[model samples]
Target: MTEESDSPMTDTDSTTTGPLVPEDITADSPFTLPGFFAALAEGRLVAARCTECDTHLLPPRPACYGCGSRAVTLSEQPRTGEVISYTSVNRPPSAFDHLAPITVAVVELDSSARLTGRVDASLEDVTIGDRVELQVRDPETVDIDPDFGLSYEEEWPIHVFELI
Candidate 1:
């Protein structure tokens, strides 16, 4: 099998060129969700924690988006979680129509941070209080707005949770 990428073959060129930003993969910050994606690429699940209150932020924010605190740190989280809320989509958005009946959910990790992610389990089997483990799956290509530079456009992975 083969595929084609319209993204810049290399971002070092003097002329900054890019195809339409590809889907939701575009990330613009390390202190934001992209930083969590980067860590997922490294086979780790990390969250932002407030040094002041020890609160965990699932999609990390530089400053504790939770409490208006400037003391935020990326802290790795426990891989296990339980389903808090979820929905099974009969029709996914255009980009993901091929994956209908997808289960998307908000899972509360053991550390008390709730994260929204697609659950990788048989649709019929998903339910509230179901035990799951955070897992990383390769995204094949990571894309981002051209202004941020190519460092953000490498092969990487994102987090998904599997029923345990």
Candidate 2:
């Protein structure tokens, strides 16, 4: 991986070649929720925060389960966390029909909130309580986009370590 300088550029005379934005991932039914897609569009991981307890909840719900607060705020989450549990899916459901046996892990964020995502690393290297990061790989660069309606580009990979 190469590091690029984070310099602000003027709109009129900028000469930096930034990363290419990849196509958004889409899904049918519940996965197509507006809030869910909005987070990814802005390159942020959004979760619901409880107004009463100030607790962050992943896979955000309309109301906080902890305090039953309807006044919830959708906020970005840190990219680092520790693996609480995980499992490899040799036979995924129909929705994940296109992905080869992928490993999924339940990660506990620094805030103690847990969210599940694909583990990009090898299965042998993954373990409970291991440090893991969130990686957003572009499907286009990899030339492998599943036909399940989700699209991604390969050249612009966004990987963030939430825990280590």
Candidate maximizing TM-score: 1
**Regions of candidate 2 where Cα sits further than 4 Å from its true position:** 1-32, 94-98, 139-147, 150-164
User: Top model by lDDT, which number?
Assistant: 1
Model 2 Cα lDDT, one tens digit per residue, 65-152: 7877666555556666778887788877665556657678888766556777778765777888787666654534332344444333
- Lowest lDDT 10-residue stretch of candidate 2: 9-18
Tally clashing residue pairs in candidate 2. 14
TM-score against native, each model: 0.69, 0.62
Error of 1 at 131 (Å): 0.5
lDDT tens digits, residues 5-59, model 1?
1221111212111112344234643344565567677766666667677667666
What are the Cα lDDT values of the candidates?
Answer: 0.63, 0.54
* Model 2 whole-model lDDT (C-alpha atoms): 0.54
